[model samples]
Target: MHHLFMVTLKTEQSKRKQAFFWINAMAPLTSVILGSILVYMTHAEKHGVQVIGHLKKGLNPPSVSELGFGSPYLMTAIKAGATIGIISLAEGVAVGRSFAMYKNYHIDGNKEMIAFGMMNLVGSLTSCYLTTGPFSRTAVNFNAGCKTAASNIVMATAVMMTLLFLTPLFHYTPLVVLASIIIAAMLGLIDYGGIIHLWTIDKFDFFVSISAFLGVVFGSVEIGLIIAVTISMLRLLLTLSRPRTYALGNIPNSITYRSIEQYPAAANVPGMLILRIDAPIYFANTSYLRERISRWIYEEEDRLKSAGETSLHYVILDMSAVSSIDASGIHMLEEVRKNVDRRGLQLALANPGSEVMKKLDKSKMIEKIGEEWMYLTVAEAVGACNFMLHSCKSTSAALTNPAAVEPNTYDYV
Candidate 1:
């Protein structure tokens, strides 16, 4: 009831009317008090009602001496603390940002983390558990319509009063009432709409959500964390190992070339296969790329043969997007060059960047492919291939000058 506010309560508060507003605000307190009184009157503890039992009145004794820094279990304690701390930080910040977005407010993440760290450090000395802005209590506070953090000060004062004077009153309070309050607060956080939206948008994300949720409910929070992390890493590795490749074609009336699949009007040049790699070349994807390139060449040849088009003559690789390459990538290039030569097709490289040129220089690959075969741009490579094709008289006239094809100049290291 405290979570719900009536519209009438907001309008013009007189002395008596304002006094009545406190009733809605203190509904949880009323419930606790009535539950405690009823339990006490019925002597429910004797009937196994599981009351709160004795309450300690006073302050926390310093537990600094219990640090056990020199104990043999120090390493284990450190490991446990580090694990729980990581999970706590992840969950707290995630929930905090959600509420911050919902409320349309801003918060400094670094300050929030620093405050939590200081609180936990100080709290540990006073025998308190590790502190975090957990979702349960956060949801409860949000539902109560807290306008500002000053509510925490009021709550702290009330708690202090309870500890100093009202300890005996809660001794008969049933644990069920407290649990019910927490459960009610947590019910607002289920977010079924979010789960359904995830399923509609992305199956993988939905799978991750369900896996984490079920793991936490059945196994443990740590197990859920492990599952989520494992699935995410697997997805990352799969994407890297099979990075996208595009069959490029020239955009009409322009020197620009783009993916044939992406640009429907882009026309494919006869007797040539132009391909683009959309990711960096690395050891993880080297083998996959080798097979993928071979497959592209094979598929292009098959498509040409089926259509009775000009025989596949040249294989042009657009290296504009390949930012980096390792030794394995260099080897893959060599293997691809050899395969193209074996298939009686001329292989040309175009627009490889400074880093790729440097790697090629280091591997003595520029000398093998030669300066005449490498071009400053894919369009220039296509021009050289078209000159070699002997299909168009006007294109032949355009490429009559040898300097028409600009080759990349690389200084070997």
Candidate 2:
């Protein structure tokens, strides 16, 4: 009925379409009320129709002393409370941010979390159980054209009025009717199109989504939430553990460097190798990164050997994307430097961020690797390495053939 009403309203040729839209939007609530009234008038309760019995009148009284802080169950309570709290917080923030994105607005996640935490604290003080922004309620609120948080205020005011003056009216509200309203609201949250889109775009994401859905349907909500969170964490760990490394090559007629795999036009520098690590340096990826760097060096050497060209000498690590480093990461870099030195090649760093510099300085790695070998940019590092390489070659040539003109060190300078 809700869908049908939307379809009709969409085609309505009326200047007061907004008024009609509001009326159409209220149809679900109206159906619940009128259905309850009809059941009450006809004495449907006599026919085994379930209705809400007497509800306690008035607002919730203070229960400041009712909170449990006892011995045997205190730890259990805390664990359970924390798990549910985190799940609720994640769901609420995800829903809120998703809607904010759809509406093209910014949502400060930290601010939202703080606001939710304060609300939960107040609720606990007043004897309320855990509450979260359920997707169904959020969808209905959005459908009802709520433009601001003021809608929440309006809803709270209505709830207070109901508690104070309209409690008796709910006595005849059938449970089945309430269930129907919930089912109607929840139908909008199915989002089959989203599932289809996910399947088309990323099968792994689709698998996660389907797994969560099946877990909830077959087991429990908590089980489903656990499965979803576990899969998400695993994905993050996998990405970090096997982070992508690229062989950077210089673009033609530009100082810019880019991945050769990504840009086929980018050309490798003669007698030099450049690599870009695309993730922060941490313990988990240090070993993998070390091995990957070695592989890149071996492949470059093989390519040079096959083509009868000069072997690699200067290995420049473009650390522009490396945001942070740990002790393990520093150790890995030391090992790499030793390996490069064993191969009679120099290791150079390009564009290390402040954090990386600080850590390296504290570990005395900067001094060990030579401060002069580090540069502000990859281009500068490559130029300096090239100049030094030419100087060496010219000195060697002068020794071999004194008649050969002196290698022009002035041109490099």
Candidate 3:
């Protein structure tokens, strides 16, 4: 019936609303009424069908004195409670955020976490088990065009009234009917289209989604949650371990520097190499950065040698994107500087942030590298290197070729 309603509904908004209402509300209600009638009109017991045989009357009594906080089991209970509490909170927040986005509203995640934590704390005192917003019920509420959380209030009131007065009415309710209602509500949560969309956009994201799905289907819900979270953390770690490093080149007729791979039209400066790091310099990535920078230097030198151009004499690091660095990162930079010096090339830094400046100053590296080598911009650093190279060439020309009348007139290009 749920599938039929979904398929037969028209494209009009009113028809969609009717479908949502029927599948989410009326269908379950109708199933319960029919089940009650079947049990009343027939000998349901002889058919081996189970019915609600009995129900306790009245509201739950207070259990304030039942609080347990003793010995070995107390610590175990705390650990288990915390684990389940975190998992439930994560699920509830994800569901809330999704609906909030769809409804064009904002939700403060931290505030939501606090609210959930407080609710659970109070609920425990009141003899309630761990409570969370179930996705199936949330989907039904959303589909019913609920304007606010007042719907939940209405639902709770209805449930309270049912427990207070309608307990006898549910005595003949069949277990199969209740199961049908649950199955119908849960069917709407299966989103095959979303999986296909993920596959088309990103294979890794599709893998994660499918892994979670299969894990839940084959293993337990806990296993699926663990697998999904583990995969996500691994992906984050992989990105940090291999952060992107780009060889920057100057845009023709402009001082702007960009990645040569991204902007193929950008040209490399003569007798100088510029490199950019695109993430924070941290201990985890320092080794990778060192090797990557070394590779860029060797590749640039090979290209210069093949072209029969002036050998690379200066390497300017564009540090604008490196917002922070650690001790290992600083050590890596020192090692890079030493390697460049061994290769008879000058190493310069451009636009180092205040934090990096302070660290370098404290480490006494700035004085060793000379404050004059650090420039405000990549363009300024390249220009200074070019001027120094031109001066050296002019002096060499004057010394080697004394017949030349004008030393400044010697062309270094």
Candidate 4:
């Protein structure tokens, strides 16, 4: 009854919302009263149905002195605290974000973190339970139509009153009734659309989600979190170790170049190969890039041979996307240069950033690669290659005069 009342209120008249809200609000209390009466009237407690027996009517006592800061198990406590704290923090922030996105609202993450941190800090002294917002509680409050932080104030006040004077009222309340209410609230939070969307867009994310769900269902929250994190890290490392590269081609009647696979109409310049790296050049991906570049060269040669087109002469690397390079990257480039030289091809670099330029200069690669071969953009690189090969009709003529080249200059099969 606490879960679906919001939908009922939405369907009613605007003026009737206020009246229906009170009735919806009374459902839980009514259930508690009725369940307690039933349990009492039927003597269910004596028949093994558990109930919240007795009452403790008082304010919290000081537990500061009970804290064993200097105990021998302090290190163990710290380790456990750190692990649980991290998992709780991540879960709390994630829940806040999920609800905020669902309701089309914004929340300041830093403010939320600080507020939860302060709550936990003060709570520790008073022997209060750890205070990160749990998803089940958030779902219940969300279904109850809580609009702002004021709901927390109301909750705190009600809890205080319950501790002081209303303790005896719940003494005969059946625990099963409360559990059922919580389960119903949680059921409303399971988003079927999100799961299907993830499955359609990204299979890996869907698999990870399933793994976490299974872990939590069969084991515990910690187990689920660890499995999700491990799979995520593995994916990250895999992508970093083998970053993707693309073959760029000129767009007809335009100076811009883009991936040929993406733009099927883009034209490939004869006698030259253009490639772009989509990640930083580092030790992790350098070796894979070397083999991949070699394969591209061989493949280009085979295609040109089959077409009886202009023999491959130049290899231009569009380095605008490659932001940085390390020692292994420099070595990989040196090896690539040697390989290109052995194939009787000239190697050219286009749009190397400041970081890459500095590393290349320090490694004496700038002098070896020749400053004259380096161009500011891929168009200029292609123009130079075309001019050298004396096939200036498509690329070089297009750069010198926009209208000199024909549309669909040179399409790759």
Candidate 5:
């Protein structure tokens, strides 16, 4: 009895899923089926210019070629219609995902795809190409107290009744009016405000949007989607290449060390640079990291040369922020160690995670840099390097203090 009850529950769940799928697919299937039949009929009539057409056309003339019939223009019209429909559905589903977040509802993407597929399958059989979820109609339903799929039944019933009884009434509706509706729908997709907003937020995003817009307007819609996706991926790689680095220090009355640029009152590690890498070390960004470190080394060398001094002494790499490492990164680290040693500067690594440490160990970097150079904490690393713990004097005093800071005439000039 228990097993039978559980089996029955599973069957009910499966039926509900099927029901929801049908609900989502029905509207697009019906709309496209009807629209296609109308197109086929109008083409058969081959009505060139009626009294109603002349009345609809103002003093400003419009194109009189009706493409609903079997012509070269008819194929182009159908192609354009399919393109617009697919784009509308893509944009609609994205909006639905956003609203689903606020409404605390879960959307099954695979099920939605099945529904969408069925819509196209049924629509094509009825002399249509393809149709998709209409954003405007869905939004209207959402606003008008549509709680369940039952609302669609009422809506479909009304539409069917209208089609059966009021066919003659729609004959008086001008061709120009229908054309205007199609044009309006297409125009809605050209999101000028969205483009502007993307530009304001990120210059890279602006470039991407511009590329996509131009591709769509000047080239083809298919080409535009391809260009947009490609550009997005390239932008992601570029971002990873220049991961943000910060000089971290302890905030007053707080144990947590934050970026000195963020908190002015934070205690800095004088005579020692505490640098934090804000990303995983990988082949893509290895050269970028090297360049940044090289810049700092060059600046330090120039200061030392003017003061008749030797070195900045120590650089503490705070690796607590690093979550992972790759083979290219290991090679980069070895090169950095060699370069720093050749320059008579000490390079110490602090707080490498277990995974990173294991990689470092496998790479045999710990012994090359010395086990003493590896510390669990930044403070311990600084102490091992024989750097001062606290700043007794202010930064102004340190700048003027001969013992703390060597005089560099070249820096002043």
Candidate 6:
């Protein structure tokens, strides 16, 4: 759908929307008219006649026998029809929502689902498999300035004209031509590069793409969908299992700090460590976060020891990127606090959102850690640590000032 959308139109949102509105309505109408034309052409052409003659082999319209309802072949056909309906509806909804996201609009998934389901139900009963909104058409609509539902009316009129006036022109169209057209359509749907892209960017999605493609080839369409959905859910679990959390620090020549992985030379405060988890804290990822913090602290201490420097005593979990936290995350937080306290290391928070703060409050995390420990910003935490360092230096200076009072150059040896 995305490829279709990209190929069919320019980048303008309004133009895309208008084109989508027209095409979405027109495509199906075109398909129906084309089907009728093919049916007519079958009677007129020699090859079509030959194909029809072959189709007539053992093709007796079902007799009114109770056995007809119980036939496995009939069951398979019914299942196939259901599969097509589901695919169409699911594709329609997903494509619709994706476009809505691109346009920064909100689509009610349930409402869209209802519309899709009803459309399929109607299509199925009317001798059409389930049909949903096509992404190409929707993308065109998104690019176009279609604000109303009137486009479909025009589409229906155009289809009527084609059926009434243009039917005879297509009477000699070969069966092989239609087969080629369908084969090309299927080829267009295949995304070999998309599979490779997914493999490079996300291994799990690559697995899904492969699983889905193979399932369709070797198994039933329903199996393909099931595998696709299951793979998607597993991918979510895999992501949460080891979420992308970065160790961040200040860039030397810039005001902004960056992920240490991206900029290793960035200055991290002495005796302090910054860990940035770029995901919502949930039950699925709570253990991963706990393990990450534990490993990071141990490694940081080891590195400091190797350098003959004071070990980092403060670990800041930068929650600015975190949007939400769950109960399991809260439990993990409590455990982290206890462990940090045991090691005489401080754990601090930075830029927790209001809702997250409220969750922390309800969990009694703020009270347990103390208000001074919670920092609103990374700079505030750095300033606090710097102040403590400066105060210690000032006290040392006061103690040593009188003992080393002036003119001690010759005593150095």
Prediction 1 global C-alpha lDDT: 0.82
Query: CA shift at 152, candidate 4, in angstroms?
Result: 1.0
Error of 5 at 180 (Å): 3.7
- How well is each residue in 1-413 modelled by candidate 2, as lDDT tens digits? 44334323432422157666666457556766886788889999889988897999887777788876677989998899898889888878877876786678998889888988998999988878777877667866775567899999999998899999999998888877656554554454567888999999999899898998887668855566679889989999999988899998999999999999999999999999999988999999999999999998999999999999988999999999899999999999999999999999999999999999999999999999999999999999999999999999999998999867756777689
lDDT by residue (tens digit), candidate 1, 1-413: 33222211321132146555554354555567877988889999999889888989986789998877788889999999998898887767766876887678888889888988998999999988789887667866764456698998987798889889989889998887776555555554567988999999999999988998787668855677678878989998998899899899999999999999999999899999999998899999999999999999999999999999999989999999999999999999999999999999988999999999999999999888877889989999999999977866557766896565556476332
Give the Å shift of residue 391 in candidate 1. Answer: 10
Clashes of 6: 18
What are the RMSD figures for all models against the true structure? 8.1, 4.7, 4.1, 7.9, 16.1, 9.7
Superposition error at 391 for model 5 (Å): 18
- Model 3, position 157, has a per-residue lDDT of 94
lDDT, candidate 5, at 49: 24
Candidate 5 vs candidate 6, lDDT winner: 6
TM-score of each: 0.77, 0.83, 0.87, 0.84, 0.56, 0.62
Better of 1 and 3 by lDDT: 1
The local distance difference test score of each candidate is 0.82, 0.84, 0.81, 0.84, 0.66, 0.69
lDDT at 236 for candidate 4?
Answer: 89
Candidate 6: regions farther than 4 A off: 1-88, 94-177, 188-225, 253-255, 392-413
For candidate 5, lDDT tens digit of each residue in 1-413?
Answer: 22223323333343367654343333333333444455456753356422121122112223233224767687787789777766755655554653465357977766776777787666555544455555446543543336677988998787667656644444444443333333333343455777788788988889987897787667755566668878999888887888887777767665566788898887665455668888889999999998887776676567666876644667778898789999999898998888888877778999999999999999999999989789998767866665332342356588787576776778788
Please give the clash total of every predicted structure, in order. 0, 0, 0, 0, 0, 18
Model 3 per-residue lDDT tens digits across residues 245-331: 888898998989998899999988999999988788989999999999999999999999999998999999999888988899999
| Strongest candidate by TM-score | 3
The C-alpha stretches of model 2 lying farther than 4 A from their native spots are 1-19, 41-49, 65-84, 124-126, 189-202, 206-226, 405-413
Worst lDDT run of 10 residues, candidate 3, spans 3-12
